[model samples]
Target: MPPRRCTASAAAGQTGSDSDLDEFIMRCLSCEEQYDMDDAGTCRECYQEANEAEEELRLEIDDLKSKVSFLTLSSPTLNPSTADIVLVPVDDSDAAPIPAHKHVLSCRSPVFNAMLENDMEERRSGTIKISDVSHDTLCAFVNYLYTAEASLDNQMACNLLVLGEKYQVKHLKTYCEKYLIAKMNWNKAIANYAFAYQYNCKQLRSASLAVILDKMDLFTQNEYYAELVDTNPRLVVEIYETYIGKQLNTAGTL
Candidate 1:
């Protein structure tokens, strides 16, 4: 061929074809990814609504954060003098006592409230002896009562959950239970189920039991299973009962 002719023509300075003009590509306002008409995410009105909703949620979250900050008390470690009562860990008596406000404790836990409000020995002595809890656990429990927060690892969460349950601190119990549930896996499932049953934590117990049921084939091989069967045969029976019930339900569904 001698000289090739331009098969596609363009108007004035324009170089793109008619197909490009009609392609209708636009970036998603929410996700900020480019999309064509076929993959269009939302209309302008819906996008604006979504943005407004997101902003409102952000403002609400900020407000809640500020409120939490305002409500949170200063740590007893930082200002021990302001505390009206002291909590001594009976299990770890050598450890330094944990100081706390009576009002704060009373507000957070019914057990504390009853102990402090009435003419109890704890109120008279201005000291409460907490048994079977380590110094670290007592500190964490007191800190959570003050701030409604805790930095939780598995052991710490379990410790605090036990304290929370005994003291009737519902919020702390729920928090720790949720944390344990989030960290639940096959390795921890059996132990967590037993712990949850012991603590009366329904959510955690159910989740852990589900995990255990899913891996029932390996149940007998688990190290903790032998101990659990030896110590709490009733709990093991309950597990078998639950598994049977689930199987029956599944068969019914089928």
Candidate 2:
């Protein structure tokens, strides 16, 4: 009889524990003010907090999704034709590359200023001789060293190559070469060749020579031929003979 009573007591305790758990789940899930299995399960306060947390998490997810989409999208200029070139639109009135920005020569570092001054001194003495690099190009170089912002115009590309060769600035040289290769008109290639040769830029010289050789007939026909011969006589003759002479000989019409 005593054993039977003990089992009955344990069963009663288990029933009470399950009833309490059901009440708690209902209160949290259903947003009820109060819940009881006795009163059909309700607790409003816990439910309201759960709803608020869900809305907060939903907004956070949306924000993260927007960021993900932005990161995945590519720039419009990533097209193959425009990949190597950065075009800056200019008005006829603005003769300079662009308006001066604070980052150009406005560094507060004395070490950087001294370096620029030294560069200027080297340039004046012709000790740091480089073909076609102007004061503006020097300014750009200083800006790049200090701020890591390099702006090379279409016309300045050739100059940058010479500057790179003179100072052994490989990064700047590569930047100019890539841009020149991308936008190489026949005339620009000829001009670049003259500067590159003067500076003993072997890679650029070979590239320029190849461009001229490939378009020898066109160069001979261009008004710039005389100027090119004056600047790089050796290259002019070599490219002319390589392409034009070969064409004439092959045709048996020389």
Candidate 3:
């Protein structure tokens, strides 16, 4: 919730006598009703400017997305003759290596650049092995490397997020974070918070914490709550401590 703010009209009369404050009737831009000046969320000007700024930001994002789309290259795998290396996902059963260009992979991920540019086995054998990820996930990752696009589900998003973090692909990690944040809710709050914290996703962690604070009474009812407590009691303690601290802050404010 936003803090109460007075309109410019209220401040205009502040230079005069204190009694002039009451003469300025508070008007809500949205509801158009008389509200106490001390009980307003925003003035009309601030609200309108915020809306305009949001729209401008949205347009800029769209423009950047368009430029990314324009710059997206056709996968070199489509022309295997042009591909210089293959990616092997060791987690899958006899998974086929996915073809990719070494330069593309190197450009997209610093980890890949280090592996391929140095005198590593991957540089010699022309095959890069990725572990702890299934072939499908690896395929999705490679496709995104080439296309700057991915069709994400919860599982895919989680998998990609891990790979993104490991490989230092900040863009892909942010993309996964946005998906996970959008899908987040009370039922998934605790697990999401734990995952976000582990992955150092500040935005997702804050969003999940907000949800948890809203439904603290229902926290224990979630099945994941017990699992989290059993697996990482420290994290559970941290959450409780955070909640208690916020409660203390609220008490102080009141």
Candidate 4:
């Protein structure tokens, strides 16, 4: 094939003019879209380098995922007979105890490690009673300790996050925080902000506060807003303080 030319005719329906023909057009190697000089993105060399970097990152992610799969234990629910210890939700007597491995629980949570490793009643009875948690939440918590996975809805995420913080399971706490942050919006913002404050989840608290600041007028009208003020007046005051600080920063910037 003859060497490709940057002719004006190359652009559909455009007649060639000396200036237009002289202007170069190239296909973007990244997006694979054609572009004229003015619309160009990266140089060919940079595009090629970017492609290499992306491939390397993809490979690294795949490697990390594979390692996670290899390290993750099978859910104790699948084979309760093999579990050495059981977790009972104190509030739900009728609920069956959740089966789990002591080693897995110990490895995941320092609280569990101390409870089981030391001369504790939990170790002797082979049963650990978890208070202020539902049977389903206990089951999910134990499953996550083993498999590092959970089927989370908003409520479940909140439940698990509370348990995660109580147990000092940092990874699970971070996971639940990210989920809540991603699901944050105007409707849930106040409630989530209150929950984050109660739980000491700074990241989720900041994100929820940002949402609340954006819709301050509507926030007071939210059903949860009054309940939060009644339940935790201190937290409500903090929200106002944050909003005021943000306004001050904006005024300074302007």
Report every candidate's CA lDDT.
Answer: 0.88, 0.55, 0.88, 0.88
Question: Model 3: per-residue lDDT, tens digit, 43-113?
Answer: 56789998899999999999999998898988766778888899999878688889999999999999999
TM-score of each: 0.85, 0.42, 0.76, 0.89
Off by over 4 Å in 1: 1-27, 32-41
- Candidate 1 structure quality by residue, lDDT tens digits, 79-152: 89888899999989699988999999999999999999999999999999999999999999999998899999
> What TM-score, to 2 decimals, does candidate 4 have?
0.89
lDDT of 2 at 126: 23
**Total clashes in model 3, counting residue pairs 3 or more apart in sequence or in different chains:** 0
**Over all chains combined, what TM-score does candidate 2 have?**
0.42
Count: clashes, candidate 4: 0
Model 4, 113-149: lDDT tens digits are: 9999999999999999999999989989988888888
The alpha-carbon lDDT assigned to residue 223 of candidate 2 equals 63
Ranking by lDDT: 1, 4, 3, 2
lDDT of 3: 0.88
Which pairs of residues clash in candidate 4, taking residues 3 or more apart in a chain or in different chains?
Answer: none
- Between the candidate structures 1 and 2, which one is better when assessed by TM-score? 1
Estimate, for each residue in 13-52, the C-alpha lDDT of model 2 and write its tens digit: 5556655454232232443354445655323466568789
